[model samples]
Target: MKVKYWTCHSDGCAANVHIDKNDHFIKSHGQHHHIPEPEQIELRNLKGKVKERVITETSSITKIYEEELARSNLSSTALTLAFTAAEG
Candidate 1:
């Protein structure tokens, strides 16, 4: 393919930038093509990872927690009282 594929070097840009093999710029397409600050991209990625991990782990444990809760004989009031006593 003689087409040179290019993308916005910006972290936040979802734009498609293209060029020809002849070193001629083809076109850059997007409503927003501004570059994101370095720290912002780092933080944004970190937050996304954390959120993904949390959702994954939570989904894995949710069924286990629900099963245990269902098997328990203790009422909500009794559980609360026990928890309060344990805290003291």
Candidate 2:
């Protein structure tokens, strides 16, 4: 059976998520060593949305960014983090 591995993002984390071809969860291994960061998660999702739009649209990065930011409804903390990352 074809499967995909979704590994943990935290440093030194050994956790992993396995999914089958149909995107059904097969099983998980190990465990996360840190608590979930909701704000960071929101920022990651926002980046993903922008990336998908960038791939499918001819719009300028600035325009796409503005549009996505408007629709994202991210928390203030997430917004601050996003802008800080962009500046770096």
Candidate 3:
């Protein structure tokens, strides 16, 4: 199919931003080299929220495992094997 687009001129970038005759900006077709300031701040905030959730979940899992180990009679080797199998 014949497609119409504009090539970005930034170094090491291969962006093909679409250009419609009636519109100044449409859709882009590559990894964006730069994000606008507002978008950058929003992305950073999202990253922070994700990191926080990961840390919280990891801590909770660790606490549960520690409690289970303390309360159960399973040997360390058995626990290790069980975890290894679960991982796979």
Candidate 4:
């Protein structure tokens, strides 16, 4: 079975997970020292959805993006960051 390793994004954090070919959790290591950033996680997921729609659908990218953002309840900070990332 194929294995994939997922590592923490935070600097100096050791938290990680191992997954099998089917994306089932195999094991985990370490722990996060800080509180979870749910908004950031949500924003990341929203971006992924928008990207998938952009790739598979024939709709205008602006329309796809507007629809996704409209459905999501991301914080002002997250929305600002998303637009900034898209602009840059």
Each prediction's whole-model lDDT (CA): 0.55, 0.91, 0.55, 0.89
Clashes by residue pair, model 2: none
Show the lowest summed lDDT stretch of 10 residues, model 4: 34-43
Error of 3 at 46 (Å): 37
Q: Which candidate is the best by TM-score?
A: 2
Q: After TM-score superposition, what is the CA distance of residue 9 in candidate 4 from its true location, in Å?
A: 1.6
Off by over 4 Å in 3: 1-4, 24-26, 34-88
| RMSD (CA, angstroms), candidate 2 | 1.3
lDDT of candidate 3 over 1-88, digit per residue (tens): 3346876555677877775676567678887586533433433444455456556676665455555545444455555554564368
Instruction: Flag regions of model 4 displaced more than 4 Å.
Output: 75-88
Ranking by lDDT: 2, 4, 3, 1
Tell me which of candidates 1 and 2 scores higher on lDDT.
2
lDDT, residue 75, candidate 1: 53
- Give RMSD to native, each candidate: 16.7, 1.3, 16.1, 2.4
The candidate that wins on lDDT is 2
For candidate 1, which ten residues in a row score worst on lDDT?
A: 60-69
Between prediction 2 and prediction 3, the one with superior TM-score is 2
Model 1 bad stretches (over 4 Å) = 33-88
